[model samples]
Target chain A: MLAKSFNIHIDNQDLLDEAFTQASYVNEHKGQNLKFYERLEFLGDAVLQLIVSSYIFQRYPKMPQGRLTRLRAAMVNEKSFSTFARECTFDKYIRLGRGEEKAGARNRDSLLCDIFESFVGAVYLDQGQATVEKFVQQVIFPKLDEGMFAEFFDHKTELQELAQADGPVDIDYELIDEFGPDNDRSFKVNVSIGDKLFGVGIGHSKKAAEQRAAQQALTHFDTEGDNLV
Target chain B: MLAKSFNIHIDNQDLLDEAFTQASYVNEHKGQNLKFYERLEFLGDAVLQLIVSSYIFQRYPKMPQGRLTRLRAAMVNEKSFSTFARECTFDKYIRLGRGEEKAGARNRDSLLCDIFESFVGAVYLDQGQATVEKFVQQVIFPKLDEGMFAEFFDHKTELQELAQADGPVDIDYELIDEFGPDNDRSFKVNVSIGDKLFGVGIGHSKKAAEQRAAQQALTHFDTEGDNLV
Candidate 1:
């Protein structure tokens, strides 16, 4: 299914093989066999942050740190990554054992999304940020808005640069609470520096929630007409 | 006051003036003004982890991640850092603004703690990890037990490494509310990560309350706060 969706011919069987192999599977396959996507995942994770940082920066030239951070959450979130896996046919390419395959591992969004990270890493080192951005636009940005991206890149980094000359400051975060049931709790967060509390945001989950808080912080800074308390 | 703390035999007033100047500060200011401590603080944040990791790796060959993490936290925490700063008289040499100086910034436990980070950074760069560990022992570990240091370094960095890895995980944190009279209300927090629920912690204030929650989360992951959940 994934093969037909992307229509990219699989010229390299080894890359696909590595992507599907779990650490357990690799161990059984042989001590002599290939290195898998774990390393790729690490590289991809770093690459993911860089690309997202770049995208948010360009999109939100004036947004504050907190807001931009919130928007970044909207962009580079896990749930969205899972959705992208289905769209890209990344699900089909993932390799799993008989037990996992029988359990619908290939159809599993989480598994497929992790592989996308490996793929992103591969794409990043292969072509650098420009091409990575293109890959992201084609694969990931369909559901994301430029506005959200702009908001998330909120000048936190900018604030950071500006604030450093003044003095050393700490980024203080306080997690307020989670609401609703176990699976569907919303999180509230507040971010502060010095005596200033700049952002407050809520998310369906904790990371998302923190991102929301970061986003709020950014927006607060950009609209610095009223001094944040 | 800071100058009064240290008695140095100066050959000439001109020499002292030159040493205080930024250009000449490099030549005779000892470790002062050569390179500010911030960069090292940045690197030390990670390098401290690497040191602790290796320390744990050798000490208890059979220990798992959780215990090691808790141990690390106890070692590097505010209380420990405060003591380290006191032992080294770290505040006496710090450069601060007139206001910060007048406000008794040197006596503030937190500021003293930050200086230890700067000192660690300085040591790490000047002599490397080996020297830094030695410095940690010589300066900070006198009152602390060997078992504590061993425990602290073992699992010390895991939680921070993990919670920070994918961002904050979804925590089902319930702010049960402010009980007692409005004048003396206490906040209660029960934070859960997945099926694991932390024991409730209380605070007299809301910000303090939330910090208690974060601290609960910290303890749940063991002191170093690895990604067990």
Candidate 2:
């Protein structure tokens, strides 16, 4: 049953086995978990900390450690887990028992969070941090965006996805630099869809800068995007 | 002067003066700071990444990423920032110029950790991750033990400081026994004052469990000391 639950994506028997082991569910379901996500969660736990730590370190420049700690706690709590779980479509694929499903465990915040944690543990075991960080950075921190307010993140990602889509759309990002040592210079980024700039964003990463700029475009286009699927 | 050198913790006035801005000193001496620790580290773009994403999801028994992330990163990067800083005495009673020193700037870890990063930036801000982690864990992590290693980090502290005044004495720590689950085990420690049990110490804290055991005993005994200062 545990093995069957983990039968999504990768077909590597070893990965499936390790994923079961890390979750510590193999034997309870049948007899043995060749591997479990426990150790990987340990690894993932460390990975998650650094990702958020680095992000907070960058995002909230003068927010101070106290606020940073609280913000981190809020972002990585059950709420973030559930948010990421939906983004990853984890609830659809998790291996739960008749009992859990019958109990409506799918939407349970704790369960959702657990799956994400186990997911981290499994991924860390399967591919290591470099691989895992992508998943975290792409999925997790965006949860923070949602936390600041839910609608904002969806709007933001939509704009970013639209802008980053290389098919056949013209996107422009312009910056009016800030006053500072050019070495540590800051800038305000404005992103455009066609002519009039849609929105403005600021950040250190051209990616983050772009994301912020895209977010502004998103907000500006919110009315146009009201019925987006 | 004061405000500018929030990052500098020199005991020498000339050095403090050189590190300060006349405006910096005025701002700091007056007790305000837009500056903080790790500004330079952030400036250098020394971002730490999670090696993995939220894996515990979709993996096994279903733990969430939220709790998982916090536990995993307890020492992930900046845990390196913590425990070690305290141990090394990086900024314990730090000395600043009379201008900045009296503002209680010397006792700030945020300031301390910042200076620590600046010092790193000063030395090799552009160094490799391995070099950076090594310098921090070795140089800084051990420093996290300062309080842990405080008045009697070892028998040497007992001997050197106490022996000098009260003739001679032997100090020893015995584990006595270990208890609890391996991951969250508790340690029972006893410090011997010449074959007599000085006091007992216990902790559920991680890292240097054995040393912490000894450390707890030393601290408790020191507070209840039946001897002279």
Say which candidate scores most in DockQ.
Answer: 2
Winning candidate number (TM-score): 2
Residue A41 displacement in candidate 1 (angstroms): 1.1
TM-scores (chain A) of the candidates? 0.57, 0.52
Query: Each candidate: what lDDT?
Result: 0.55, 0.50
For candidate 2, please provide the TM-score of chain A on its own.
Answer: 0.52
If you assessed candidate 2 against the hidden native complex, which CAPRI class would it receive?
incorrect
| Tens-digit per-residue lDDT, B172-227, candidate 2 | 66677679898888877766667766556666743344445444444543222311
TM-score of every candidate? 0.37, 0.43
- Write down the C-alpha DockQ for each prediction: 0.02, 0.07
